[model samples]
Target: MPPLAIMPVLRFDPAAVAECISPLPPLEHTTLYENHNCSTSSTKVLYQIATHHYDNGVFEMKWGRVIIICAIVLSIQIASADTLNLTAGTYETFADNRTVQITANLTDSTGYPVNGTRVNFTTDLGNLSASYNYTNASGIATVNISSWDIGNATITAEAPTATNATVNMTFVVGPVSKIVLTSILEGTVNTTHLITATVYDKTAWEFANDENKWRIMPDVKLNFTITPPPGSTYNSANITPPSNTTNKSGITTAIVRLDKCAGTNGINVNVTNEDGVDVHESKTIIGVAGAPVNLSITANPYNVSANGIDTSQITGKVTDVFLNPIISTGSVRFNTSGNIITKPLDGTGEAAISIGPSIFTVNVTVNGTYLDEVGNSTNLTNETVVVFYTEEPARIVVTADATRISTTDIPGVNESAITAAVIDRWGHVLSNRSVNFSTTLGDLSSTTAITDANGQATTTLHSDITGDATVTASTLNDSGYEINGTIVIRIMNESFVSVITNIEPDPVEPGGIINVTTVISGQGNITGTRLAAHAMLALDRSGSMDPDYYAGTPLDVVLVLDRSGSMKFLGSGPEQPMTDAKTAAKVFMDNLVSNAQVGVVSFSSSSRIDTGLTLLHSSDNKTLVRGAIDGIYASGSTAIGDGLADANSMLVNGRGDARKITVLLTDGVCNAGSDRDCSNAIAIANANHITIYTIGLGSAEYIDEPLLQRIASETGGTYYNAPSSSELRAVYN
Candidate 1:
């Protein structure tokens, strides 16, 4: 008999289940336990009930006990594993009711196919053919899905009875159905127009009756192209954004711009579907002619003879606001007096006519009527005056394009166009005559030129010299009399005026006040009748002007020499003091410019003129000064006051416009004359605008240093002391 108690539930690791069940009897006669929710790595529980005993006929229930049993049953169910997996044939598809096949695979934890299992399907977007399906012999369940809406679709498959047996996959759905292109029908040439292509997608059949069946497709790439009208020489239509993506509104735009001529433009848009199929749409834009904004009339040989043999060409032109010629079908009607003629426009939108000379001046009017590519008509009118004259070569007139031009050596910089018109005594122009041109101070482009139909001959004159250029034109008439015409062109050079202002008392110090008279003078080659001049006076109080700042101005200088008895002594040098003084004086004279004048005054007991103010403008004048300096001798007591007075006299009567300067040298005090105090002489020098530079000769003890310094300082000059005769040359310099 078997034990009455039921078999205790036993737990074992899944890995050990095979080991624990191996002790059972042969499979045909063994009792088996099946687990409906077992995983590969999870713990499994087993329960068994037996009515018969083991081979020994004894009941045993213990760990690791041998089992003599019947068959064992196993049902696999993985923990958190995907046994029912859903997959699509294609991951992406168009929203135009495109169908995608989905397969759900069912398998056990041991990789054995699970047959006869039901799999249920669900989706977040789109539709499934069936909500529930059963696995076939291969453990695969299949279903069909479709969608009209553009979005991502999630498909889920689940085995309801199995533990953790569910799976889901995502599919992409987009739009690629049709495109509709739209644009304005009419547009002007040389203008931009907007063209739009609206894209849409197809939905499922269940939404066929609803307006939402068609959805907007975004981020779809589209390509645009343009086809010009037939018979066009060039394709003038341009499209911007040849390839673009659609916006959120499913609309893509392209700008089509027309240029030059009016014509029809065909716009095409192409889009490819996910399956590599291309769809196309087209629109036509008519480029029409704009309104005739401008009309013009012209006549060649405006001055024509009354003789019928001479003819003039009259042309009329039509243009749009954009300056494009309107070449469409059009006729120009030209009216002169009571006579009228009609002519068709050429390809350039211009019509021309030939008219004979009239007795009286003729005024011609033209009217134009044209049609654009769209059959719209525009009318415009323009008028021009024509001069008709009798033929003869009588009176001649000459004129210049520029009467005054700056002088330049460059070929085109200074040029004047000279034209000569030959006319009859009745004021009628004559044609086909040869004329000769001549200029006084410039070169002519051509010496001779033939008159055109307008009875005018032109020549270009170029000059590099500044002066009046007299141009003459001469021609022979029918009567063999020479007809001459003359005109003048002034070739001017650049000129500027300079105004110099000088104050009578120059360089007023920081705190000194004195009456000053400013003398202003203007000098240059600028001449004009009744031309008033303006000048400004500016004084620089810095007193840092260079000695040569006035180098260009003529300078008058006087040399005051000391011929006292002490100067005759030979002191500290190989040469006598008198000799050194003479040598230094000559050196100073040599340093002056040719425009500078020099005078010499020698004083002992009294002062006497050795040479009057003489300019060294020539070698002969310089020789005279050198001779006077060499003839000087030292003698008698020094009378510096008398010497200064004599030097001032020479300068005061000298060149009125020259700068007055005096260089005085003395070795002794002013002890020989009543003017010894030298105050009177100093005052006279200052009043005369004279600058005095004084040098004390010999040693400091023998020279009157204070008197020399006073003389220099009082007259805005400098003082120097020569300790020896060797320094006399440098001191003078």
Candidate 2:
């Protein structure tokens, strides 16, 4: 500011304060002015001038020192002036805990930072917070709090910055809690549905002001609005999920529960989605009713052979069923015979089922089951089996069809009649049913047929029979057929050979011949001319009758009393012998003739020749008739033919069609007559087809089978040893 004045000082160093003072104008060049002024005028003038120069220089130096000191002071003041500032934010605390941190940073007002400045603490997080924090070298201040809650608290720092002097922030502490809602799926009436808008409030967004328009959005929520068929309602108390969970999946389940309310038929519901719209659909469940029934049966399979071709027999009775039978009137039809068969056989005399297909059905009645041969009656009202038949094999007398010993016919004889007589291995008849010959290549029928006694026909081939024919006999339907069966033979072929004559018994004719010459002659001879009869009359007569038993043993026999037995004694001619035993003898002969050939052996103790086996003959049926009448008187000791050999012999060899037989009639025993040779005679008679018919006169005890049989059986006849006169008549008949 004053260089001129300071120039004097400018030449100086501050270290020369002492030196400048030391050159003090000469302190007092002192009083020199005064002294000089007094001494001389010129001296006075020069003294004044020197004094002025000194005064000026001294003033200038002094002023320069003052300027330099002032400059130095101002530089010192600028070097040390700045302030601290602080900022605050974000503090956390427990729910209702109200504890958090408040911070304020320090810096100067012009934006220059200041460190180590003191700061005031804040509020806002819950209830508790620190009041102050020093601004570290970074100019930041922080505080830890104990509790904070209540909400809407403020944190301010007083003098946190050198210029602003204070800092503040507002905080709203909200409830820090998690809320959850759980729900089940719901179904809709149709396939799809829309959602209505949904709203939620979450603690995360508690800071969002409601006045700002939207509620705080939650972390998760089972919030959905599914639109069902219009006007859909829910069965569940709450259309929305109850509070427990917050997952979206839960929302689906909730919809299902609601839809179910529409009825188990299926249900639908509506809900509001954040953006409402009908979109997805829910599904319904399924259920069951009850168990099913199992029906079964055991039957002959479709393809096998059984009994007849009939269904009834083929599929036999269900003899046993675990269930109840079908009942009618009073009985149950529960059984079958299990056989099907053809009927009415031909010349074989014995009918068999196998001819056709034979099937039998067992009859089932209310009582129980039995064979048709057993309790077999029609079961329309009583459950009996009818053993019905179907169309039968047309009875055709197949006679040598083209004659190659038709295997299709009778195997051996080229002719076979369609007959039910054929039976199966099972003994079942080839049912009276139809014969179905159904092979690809076979003659099923004869264009021409002849009817017969048996509703059968004689089949005449159109041209000739050939190739193969498969036949099934069945009574069932066109469906059924008889499978297995067989055939048999004729019965008239069983007969015996020789015939016999003559006996030694007293009543018998002596010769071993019966005179049928006339009758035989009338019938004509086996030759154009034969003289054998003439020669017979003159033949050797040495052949006397052999003893019926031993030489003249009386024949043991019974005689007719005057009762019915006596009727035999009244006859004449061939029956004339009845006069002795009376008509009873003749009647006896008639009866004997029917069953056995009889040689008349009349005896009365000592027997005599009456009509011998020679006169009695089955061929000379007249002789046989005559011999029956020859009778003996019942008197004296009963004699028995030890053997009726000779008389028995007469009956044999005398038969044409009649059985050779010897009949001995006596009222007495063999006591008077030797019974010795009787047995022998019996032997002889037996070999000759001669038998004795004996009748006891009265008592049942009078006749012994051994004795009678000896004469009768040994001779191939049976004895009718009657007991009383009444029985005697019966025996004759």
Highest-scoring model, TM-score: 1
The parts of candidate 1 lying over 4 Å away from their true place are: 1-83, 90-94, 108-110, 150-161, 171-173, 203-213, 293-733
lDDT (10s digit) by residue, model 1, range 397-434: 99765666656642222667788988776555567899
Model 1 local distance difference test score:
0.70
Off by over 4 Å in 2: 1-103, 109-111, 124-138, 142-150, 158-733
- Per-model C-alpha lDDT, please? 0.70, 0.33
What TM-score does model 2 achieve against the real structure?
Answer: 0.23
> Could you tell me how far off, in angstroms, the CA of residue 634 lies in candidate 1 after the best superposition?
99
Model 2: lDDT to the true structure: 0.33
Highest lDDT against the true fold, candidate: 1
> What is the Å distance of residue 398 in model 2 from its true position?
19
Q: Looking at model 2, which ten-residue stretch has the lowest summed lDDT?
A: 69-78
> Which residue pairs show collisions in model 1?
29-70, 30-69, 30-70, 30-71, 31-70, 31-71, 32-72, 148-203
What TM-score against the true fold does each predicted structure earn? 0.32, 0.23
Looking at model 1, residue 714 earns an lDDT score of 96
